[model samples]
Target: MRIEDKITTAFVLASGPFTDGSLWDAVSGRLGAAGAEVHAVTFSADPESHAGEVLRLIDSAAAPQVVLVGHDYGLHPLLAAARQRTGRVARIVHLDTAPPQDGDAPLALLPDPATQALLRDRPQALVPAPAPGEWARFGSTAGLTPEDLERLSALSEPCPGAVLTRPLRLTGALAAVPSSGILCTASGASIAGVQQLVSSGMPQFQALAEPSVGFFELATGHWPMLSCPEELTAALLLAAAGGGRRLTPAVTRPFHERPFVLDAAEAPRVRTGLVDLHLPAAEGPRPAVLLVHGGPLPRGLTPTPRDWPLYLGYARLLAGRGLVGAVLDHRLHGLSDYPTASEDLAEAVGLLRADPRVDPDRIALWFFSGAGLLLSPYLAAPAPWLRCVAATYPVLAPLPGWAGVDPAFDPAAALPMAGALPVVLTRAGLESPEIAATVAGFLDAADGCGAAVELVDAPHCRHGFDCSEPTEEARGAVRQAMEAVCAHLSGRVPIRD
Candidate 1:
């Protein structure tokens, strides 16, 4: 298909007072992440700023029904071109500017007398730095830290004067393409003004409210491209997605309030903690999965591929799929220290059960290897909120020299609880039948619980193999298990719609 026919490309036209197209660098990364093609253009002052080059670039760079994005002075001319190529323009996004007023002189028209006297003596303002710190002066710059600011400062360049001297006459363009304006607090006195102008009784164009073509104002200076790139990127993407809702950016903070402190009183003096939280979205409540990690916990282990970091990746995948998946370090390992870890798991389950964003009626427990033992007590007296349990290569039968560990560490004790809950068990090639037998014995004794067993042929498949080098079989196993859990929660057959 021709590029313009694709309808997925977005053209971000930039105005030149400053040739450095740094304004787009961060927002472009976000668009790329969200799977869109972006191109930046500069209409350097001269006749190029007036007309010809701008339309040509739009013709060459954009797809059919392009989302034409313009910043600063570029807004008016791009709108004019978009009007000319109405069929090719899907939406016109004006960042901190609006379409020109009727009777407003076009660039070809001499500088209007009203503005000429003022500009004749307009003192030259210093070229302001577009650094991160400079952007923080605006309220919209929240969530931006010094480092992000530093990155932007490095890419910024000086602005030119000629581009600023020109004013756009967009009356002709407004009659063609639909336009939406993203205005900043600094430049335009109010979004209401633009709305009023676009509303009724205006000399320019008819103010019929085009819901799709409107304005959104952020509490920031004239430059949102610099002050709040993340927010801007999010808003722009929403605009691109036909005005989708925005998600709050992830925050970095302590999982608990006590604050981290190390007490060298015990042999393994590392402090550990467990936390369960839900990320609420407007999409409605989603399934919540609880993660329990495997044996011989690594010292000070955070999420990395070497250990079962694959589960963390899986949780992210689940979250992306409109489900709420949580990962927690069990007691005696990870960030949670000793007795607290076990308490945390139970508390987390209880908490999720009470949460409105989580389907309190349908929580699934995902246990792998040694971590399977942590849920023994709960299995023994399974919570009303617990819907199903999946144990992959769980060490169900206590081996020799297993009694010295934590009481909650006894899967053998928890085995009886399996009778009341649905169970899924998986064994890989490297895992022996002895592992399966241990789990089977427990399930066999349970009155209502029969394990769904899946065994692989290879005798050497290591633990966490699915996570480390995922194959179709492994993915199938996880997907099947998830579907089973969802089915148990929903009280229906496990089938993907």
Candidate 2:
């Protein structure tokens, strides 16, 4: 990759995790030769103080206008500074790192969430920088050589565990700031890969498809400055000029807003802040199917999941089938909040069984997406009242990134304990790699333990097919899964047609 035009915008390089400014010496020289002024930052303090360091550098620059180029942990300080002075930044380039939200600490985004929590709780704990050879545990080291590793080891420092413990406050100041992403392919991620995640409506990557953002990819590992300095320089130059591949925002609506594929059957619904009940006009008690919506959704998300079309449609559809439908709300906003979510779910179920209108002897719990984690307890020790478990595109095991989440939340590991509890899972053919792996793992575990699992395949569909897919395959799969769940609720196994 080569840039025809020289770049005049000053580049403020923010180093990630273990490295410092000197790590960018080769890259800085290359940028300087191309007529750009460069300042590689050594983050001597916390994220906020590093922001001040960046601000001071910006203040001392001749043009007083700079492009903030940040890699991994370096992004926190760069983002902090950018939020402070959005007008002065030419562009913010995220170099192969997860872009942190307003309150996201490094621990939340990094691989080991459990270990990070342990370290955070200890008094004056610090995150020890890994020895050069051990860096692969943190990120891909596909392109670095022995010499490169030695150099990287020399240009690094131990991180203070306290950094970003306090949230980086955002005032929506960075919304208008144009941004770019530099993806490292050898790091197990690519520009195309990111687009796929954005298309899934994961919320976090939604901003990447906005008109103000662009993306570039390098066929190297995480540390592009060390592995491919010339190529990195070229991409940075183009990015500074607002030139890179721009993603067209996905046209599919999110699960909350999209109309459910099933036709809405009019049924009377009662709302209780915690659970929404859809009832059939029946005289006696009826079997109930609890519809659990999936999410790590923010508390502020309007028209909560229970009020969403998917949940409402499912509840009404069940009621029309001469059964009671219960839609529940659980608190599951962050990575570490699984315990809170579980407790909320348990309370909702207790309230559900105690209701006069619901037959306590016959009940089924249906889980979806991220709520898939909550399925563990019910499967691990199926209660006599629990009839069946139904899940759609569910995450059975923690994704690779969630290495430190509680192992007890794993449904795959709990399969052996799911004695005779009929299970139905709807799998998506086009699901993302991260999600597909978990679903596959769960099925494999169930097979190994001889657990009863009925699989329904939705071929050529994305993750949230029920909401986004307007095709026959998706609708058919949903119907099949529902039939299996209802059959089990009525004390019988569904016979395949």
Candidate 3:
């Protein structure tokens, strides 16, 4: 089938002043010739808001299926738009650009030190076109002809520094969307981080390397559209037609048929209070685990669909292992304080225990980050149904502003009452001093109380290992930690060092 037949509208988003609509003429022309409606957009200052603008453009086009093609900084807005409009985006094409992960800044992704310096100096302002010598160092690397270089330089506008520095916020919305990358292999070899992404088997680059997110290489430099337009166009068409190789399958699961609803009246402030249960296709009640996510809340943010890739992946993993996995979205800091979150968790436990498919006697709790604070009360009065508790890079101490929410927020304080409930704690070696101190204090208290606590140290990793692109060391540590948790739930506690 033709690419145009698959996508009704295609938006070609050009990178800031580095290139413009004219630079994409060759590529867009080819797409247009293939019978797809193409719209090329360029933004002025305050590029952070460009995503919204692109959304407006897509809405204005009113096409059922849309394809977004982004180059350089253009990829940022494209990602933002794709995240917000996941259902509408048919496919995404990254032209000689590294797909930005959550919390990545465009400036940080640049492999060139010179480019970094140029961006840092112009904070909250506009960066003028590069000088002739600088252009030769940066622009000419794209394998553009002298005349093409002159035209690009003439069309270059002042790029917003804010756009380079602002972090991209992702909510795993694009995980299901098919994406393709046209890598400029020649220029990528010279870029500092690109080589690592291409060679070092980095975890962050796993999404790009995955089979669902297909990639093609071009012999040209950074601007494949300018240096190798025909090949770039072909790559885009292939991606649109779903004809690219993928390394790994997208992380998704088809489990139980419907969502088990929670009473919002019970916890009114909770966001979409629902427990998504994933159960293995089996005959009897199975061992179950409640997956709790962490959040202190970002100030003034509205609630959206909960889409933590880590918990989702873990839920699927647990279900595949013949256990029922329950994911709960508790109240956040701003929506409701610690008390509400704890109440919601209690309610989730009740729901799980009441479910016919879950083995109430063999339930476990897995906590991440701030949600670990909620474990304090549970430890203070250990429940028989709760077989074990697992925490990953948790926040054991209470936040200053949230002291009133839970007076017994300190995990150390509850250690003496923990009794014989086995606890597994995964600590990141490079964690910040505050968190390290909290973990240390908790361990000391646990030891003093004779609580059965197991420590799994990820010495080389920082916090959020599951979310990060995994190095070999990080991958091994995560796997070991997961195995320990699974074993604990299965009535076999692995001997700890």
Give me the candidate number with maximum TM-score. Answer: 2
Q: Residue-wise lDDT of candidate 2 within 19-59, one digit each (tens)?
A: 88999998999888887888999877555577799888877
For every candidate, C-alpha RMSD to the true structure in Å: 24.6, 3.5, 14.8
- Give the 10-residue window scoring lowest on summed lDDT in candidate 1: 262-271
TM-score against truth, every candidate: 0.38, 0.88, 0.47
User: Model 1, 74-181: lDDT tens per residue?
Assistant: 665676667677777777887754444432222211112322223335523223434566543322344445765676566555433334444443444455565666
Point out the worst 10-residue segment of candidate 2 by lDDT.
488-497
Cα-based lDDT for every prediction: 0.52, 0.80, 0.67
Put down candidate 3 lDDT per residue, 1-497, tens digits, no spaces: 64656655565555654556777888889878876677788675667578887887777765566778887778888888889888888888887665655665666444444555565576676666664335644422557777766767777776667877787788877899988776675653322233223332223344555556766777777677677778877887787777665554324221111121111111111122468787665558878888887765442323311344566666766676667777887765431256668888999999888888778888899888778888988899998888899998887875321212334566889989999998989898977555677788899898788998988888887666655535666666666766777786775322121
Relative to the true structure, candidate 3 reaches a TM of 0.47
Kindly report which residue stretches of model 2 are placed more than 4 angstroms away from their true locations once superposed.
Answer: 1-4, 46-48, 201-205, 283-286, 296-299, 331-340, 354-356, 359-361, 381-384, 398-409, 491-497
Prediction 2 TM-score vs. true: 0.88
Please say which candidate is ahead in lDDT: 1 or 2: 2
Superposition TM-score, candidate 1 onto the true structure: 0.38
